[model samples]
Target: MKIYSLINEFSSLDPCVFTLGIFDGVHIGHQKIIKNLILRSRKKYCSVLLTFHPHPKEILNTNKKFFYLNTLSERIYNLKKTGIEHLIVHPFTTNFSKLRTKDFLKKILHPKSKIRKIITGYDSIIGKNRDSSYEELKKISHKYGIKVYKVNPYKFQKKIVSSTHIRESLLLGNIQWANRALGYFYTLSGNVIEGKGIGKMINFPTANLQIDSKKLIPKQGVYAVKINYLNNMYLGMLNIGINPTLEKENRKIKIEVHIFDFFENIYGKKIDILMIRIIREEKKFNSIQELKKQICMDKINIQKFFSCEKKIR
Candidate 1:
């Protein structure tokens, strides 16, 4: 797919069918809309996907903290798999957020732009104060001879599949349910960093990860996960919590993973952790021996879980 940094850079004169959204996570709901967009564009239109950079919320809501399911690079990677012909990553500034509905449409749907149609989700809204509904969009686009279509909500197990719902599930350590909603394993990518070597003393040496601050972290717990390093996959167990047993006063959360049957110096390498299931919540143990004993049991359980998973597959 060809990517443009601005809408004006998309100089193609062919009629285009486009959809615009942050598309965080690119979950099932967003997939449904993209599927429709591709189908509609197959005949005479080129499929275009327009997204914003730095996320609009980051600029508009300075006081509130927002976590993203995927970083900008990850979002682009996921969207590329959807087979869209063109992608426009427009710069989202405070001034751009102030554009009225009609003005925004005019910028993208003007006669010279050749935007034949727009596909949006049922709940999509845009423009100043986000007051433009589908009806409003259709009315304004009509003047530019553009058609608007809205994709119905996609649901799983009778519940709407959304990025917010997936985030909530992850925050609650419901990895299995979150994976179902995401249509894939939830992944956290980061670089390996030096740690205190406490796990090594217990014969469970871990690779500490330095994750992106903007990425959303799952609930603090020990989890069964698969680690991807240098294009290779390995089974592992990850912990996302403060080491209460080893530290008395330190409370900062740490993310470390123990890859089973693997040993190598990966202090500065990047890896992707795909969360599978939560093994247990973080707890304070009375001694290092007690913590080691619990981790041994967790390892056994995770091994059995993966063994059964292989059988089922």
Candidate 2:
């Protein structure tokens, strides 16, 4: 996919079928629009996925904190897998947000991508004060000689698949619901960094992770996870929290993974940890032996989860 950063690169005037959104998790609902865009593309019309950086909320200076399911890089990573032809990542800012619906349509939306058709959800809107509506979009699209297609809500597990719901599910440690809505496991990917080697002393050596600060971390707990290290998939258990059992001066949250039966000098290597399910909440154990016993139980439970999931498959 060709990535055009609207902040630094000149916009492409290629005529294409396009859709626009922040697409936080690019959950099942967002994927529906993307899938349609790709399907709609033909010899005459190419597919374009347009999104924004800093997210609109940050630009709007909203009171709500921006907690996205995927970081910008992660979003790009997932979008690339969808086989889209082109992507335009417009930088969202206060000035950019000032563009009213019509101005946005005329200046950025139409002219830059020369969109022949737009594929988006019925409730989707972009611009100041969430100003655009499906009805309004249809009107302007006609004037611009463009076709507008609204995709219905994509539902999973009886509820509409959405980024907000996915984030909520993850925060609540409802991994099954979140993963179902996401159409894939939510992942924490980053470099493995040096750690205090406390896990090694306890015979449960772990890889300390340095993840993106902006990425929305799931609730603090122990989880069953799958890790991809240099193309090898490993069954793993990870803890996401400051080890309450340890009396460390800095009680900052940490992500530590223990890949079952795998041992290697993985420090400085990048790895992707996919959250499968939350096993238990982080707790302060009375002794090191108690912590070890809990970890052993976590391992057993994770193996069971994988075994049951395989049987279901």
Candidate 3:
């Protein structure tokens, strides 16, 4: 997909069939909209997707911490995987947040992509001060001659599939259910960096993942995960904690992953770790021996989980 940082890049093209949303998690609900967009785009001969970085909430409320399902790069990567042809990622800022509903439609959505058809959810809103709604969009569509497709909201496991729901699940360390709604594993991506070799000392050497401190980490726990190194997938036991058992005084939480049956230096390599299941919550052991014993059980549990999953698949 061609990513356009600014709308002017496609200023001369005819109106395109597109969908707009934060598309966080690109969860099942978002997938429906994107799927419809692809089908419609094929019929209309124009495929486009418009999303915002920094999220509207982040821009409108500076005091609040920004929590997102996918990082900017991850969002674009996931969208491109969906066969979207054009991607317009606008930077969300306080000034942009002030655009009136009509102005946003006319100035940004319509003029920028000259969108022929807008596919959005009934609850989706945009424009200055969050003034736009499905009702307003319909009226605007009638006036502008652009078609609007309002997709129905979707539910999974008897609950609405949404970014908020997924965030709640992850924050509570519910990976399996979150993955069901996400339509895939919830992955954390970053570069592997050198650490203090504490894992080695404990006889469970691991890869330390260096990531954005601002990134919303899943609840502190040990999890069954799959780490993608280069192009190979390896089952791993991932630990996210403050290392209380070790009495580490840095107070910095660390993400360490122990790859099963693998023992090689992977420092500095970029990797993606997809959380599959939460094995246990983080806790401080009475001694190093106790912590080591718990780690053994974690590995065994992870092995069983993956084995069962594979068999079911």
Candidate number with greatest TM-score: 1
Which of the two, 1 or 2, has more lDDT? 1
TM-score of every candidate relative to the true structure: 0.96, 0.93, 0.94
Show the colliding residue pairs in model 3. Answer: 99-128
Q: What value of lDDT does candidate 2 attain over all alpha carbons?
A: 0.85
| Cα lDDT of model 2 by residue, 165-253, tens digit | 88889889999899989989999999999988888998899999999887888999999999999899999999999898885677888
What pairs collide in candidate 2? none
lDDT of 2 at 70: 90
lDDT of 2 at 297: 89
CA lDDT for candidate 1 = 0.90
RMSD of 2: 2.1
Candidate 2, residue 214: Cα displacement in angstroms equals: 0.2
User: lDDT score, residue 251, model 2?
Assistant: 82
Candidate 3: clashing residue pairs, number: 1
lDDT of each: 0.90, 0.85, 0.83
Q: Point out the worst 10-residue segment of candidate 1 by lDDT.
A: 124-133
Global Cα lDDT for candidate 3: 0.83
